[model samples]
Target chain A: MSFVRAEGIFQSYGRRPILERVDVSVKEGEFISIVGASGCGKSTFLRLLLAQERPTRGEIRIAGAPPATEPGLDRGVVFQRYSVFPHLTVRENIVAGESFRTRWGRFGGAARRAALARADETLARIGLDHVAHQYPATLSGGMQQRLAIGQALAARPRILLLDEPFGALDPGTRLTMHDFLSELRTETGMTVFMVTHDLAEGFKLGDRVLVFDKPRWDPTDPDAYGATITYDFDARNGGIPFQTPEETLHALRTPGPDPVA
Target chain B: MRWINRQPGTALRAALVATPFLLLFLAYWIGSEIRLAANPSDRLLPAPGTIAATAERLFTEPDRRSGQILLWHDTLASLLRLTAGVAIAAAVATVAGLAIGLLPHVRAALAGLVAVVSMIPPLAVLPILFIVFGLGELSKVVLIVIGILPFLIRDLSQRVLEIPRETIVKAETLGASSGVIALRVALPQLLPRLIQAVRLSLGPAWLFLIASEAISADQGLGYRIFLVRRFLAMDVILTYVIWITLLAFLMDLALRWLSRRLFPWAEAGL
Candidate 1:
């Protein structure tokens, strides 16, 4: 079985089908990005992975556990909004993962040492060690997002679910976070499943990108907004390279905000 | 910026705005004092000089005194009732907040009833409680509790509910059980708001103590106010009113100090 697998996943909200037998698979330690326009069931798919929502007619297995029940420590998730607790300090937020685990009478000293070590190391990676004791409100938006990333990474989960974690940042800060995530993923080999609307962000970070669209909603009209998987391929692994043909790139760059991808 | 609000010298602006009211208030006090002096009767409104002497005799002379005087007796009685009521209300309301906030169906079923109960003015319940518990501390304490518990529970429940969904999800995804998430994630977010709620509850409680003691009790500021009221002694009433307002002001400031000490980040302006 794949490390993270969704076999023919289908989701419907009140008789309106959003995902119709959508299937996507991420191997161990692989980086998969889902890119689509707004309302294409990207967040719904992440919710399915996070076990916040169950698919209407399919199964998602995370390291041999069903996503519907028994949420394991193997999956960590970060979102675009309110990911960090406003009242908690950075160090406190990072160590939240360890607070929930059972050490069986042995976790106090050694487990503490290990969680601290992980927190310190992740703080360094996220470049937020200077403000480790500061609350989230004191930090900038970029820093808060990085702190959220730090908390998610602290537990060293097998797979990470990132739903537009950087979608709300300025272009410069978004680039910086992208660089941090790329390097962190490379070194730690934490499998990442990301959802983003920015084409360039998806292109630069995705080992493979899944494009989705919702068919326009109409009972009789067949295109009635049923979430359909548009493009699914290993863009970097054996799948055809999506070469934009430099001429087209050069033509696009000549004007109009420099064609993002 | 609004014309009145955004000005260079805030102190000057505030003083300018307050000057008229302060003058009127001072004028009234002076007018009352002048009226008392002209009357030459201590029973009506004691002259400022005589009232000062009365206040000094009533308060400062008893500086060495410890257990019960007007100042000590009223203060101690009010504080004791306030503390017991606040403690019981906070403890019970916090539990109710958690149970009602965390459980959706539970809140939906009970919220309407809580709303109904909270609407009936708390002072109205005193007569009923007095009949049941007798005109004693229990009646006053239970009255304060009934007055404050509904608000404490309602405010805390809403604030607890307002905690972002992501924080809970983050904890659960990392293997936190329901209890752990509630204690760690939920409680911390709820605390600052709860402190403000407690302060709101305290204001009415201080009012209730004086109101409850007005006709029934033999001691307390309300009793003092009542004693002076028999002779149209407005000076004593005014003195007691100032004293009670000051006490409330000090209590509120103390609560704020405690909040700042415990949660320093909240105090630092962004």
Candidate 2:
């Protein structure tokens, strides 16, 4: 069986649909990047996979089990903002990554020491060891995102969900984060699903890229429709060269007949 | 040298702060001198020396009937009532605030009621509290809790709401249960805000405590001050007022220090 199976998923708010009849299957340890126009439900899809939200119709299965009713240890997520706990030092933040594994979400004595050791190792791997004693606020934005990623990875989750995790970072920092993520995935061999507006980023990081879009737009009743996977590209096979977000969006809006077929 | 141009240094800032107090003391001293020259026994504004003497007596001398220093007894009594009231309010507010902030049903049910309760004048219910709780320590403590509880609950709930949705979702994805999210995730962040809310509530808390004490209490700072008011003992009243102000200032400082020491990263943005 596929590691993650989402079948005929449909999500909506009130009468306004966000995702429509979406289906995708991810193999174990595969990295899939989802790119879409703004407000095209890319993040919503990610939230569904993380089980932060339930699909209104159809079902998702992870590891042969039904999709989790709520977010759990098997799925770790890093958002673009407020991903780090400000009340904790960097070391404590990393330790908090394993909160779900411990009883009552806390580590004590030997477990605490072990968690700290793991936190230190994660910090070192993320090149954040020097700021271990510092608070997330004291770190630069890139460092904070790195700490967030480290914290998410510390849980040793089966899948890592990134909702534009590097969207807020500067160009230079974004490249560094891309490399860091690539290296971390290679080392951990964990499945990754990232939703981003940056087409180049999606192409660079993903082994496969899924484009979500509205195949038909009714300008009179815009809210009547929702996004679905319209284009699937094998990024590693050089199916298409990288396109700017604007160009990609334009293409999605004005697709040729039988675009998906 | 250029006072208007440059920001004050630490020592200068300290001196600048002291300047107002010094000027106020001088004005009081001068006013007392003028009043005393007109009439040697001016009860409305006692001489600074008389106020100082009252302070010395209140601090050092014991009451003839009770054989206990009145100032210490009053201070201790007032502190006990304040501590009990604030503790009860804080505990209740924390629990209720979390429930209202995190759970949509709870928020929908209670938010409006809390808002309405907060709008009712706390002092207006002083008589009702006395009628319900009677003329005892229970009444005084209960009055304080009633006065500050709504405000604390509202402030803390708002603070909890201000916590980023991402943080809570992130915690959940880490396998944290709802209880764990409330305790481990939300509570720590709310503590610093709780301290802040309490600090802001101190003035009103004291107002309720003193109002309750003044109306009916055998011993308390407010009781002592009101007890001597008939004799126009301004010196004793002034001394008590200054002492109360000092105590309030100290409490605020202590809470701020505690918040910083306990959760240094709270004020630092995530």
Going through the candidates in order, state the TM-score of chain A alone for each one: 0.82, 0.89
* DockQ for the candidates, in order: 0.44, 0.57
What stretches of model 1 exceed 4 Å from their correct place?
A: A70-72, A103-110, A216-224, A237-261, B1-11, B17-21, B42-50, B62-68, B268-270
lDDT of 2 by residue, B87-183 (tens): 9999999999999999899999999999999998988988998899999999999989999999999999998999999999989878788888888
iRMSD values, candidates in order:
3.1, 1.3
Model 2 stretches astray by more than 4 angstroms: A237-261, B1-16
Clashes of each: 7, 0
Candidate 2 chain B: minimum summed lDDT over ten consecutive residues — where? B261-270
Give the alpha carbon lDDT tens digit for every residue of B42-117 in model 1. 3654555666776676675553555435666777777787789888998898888887888788899988999999
DockQ for the candidate 2 complex?
A: 0.57
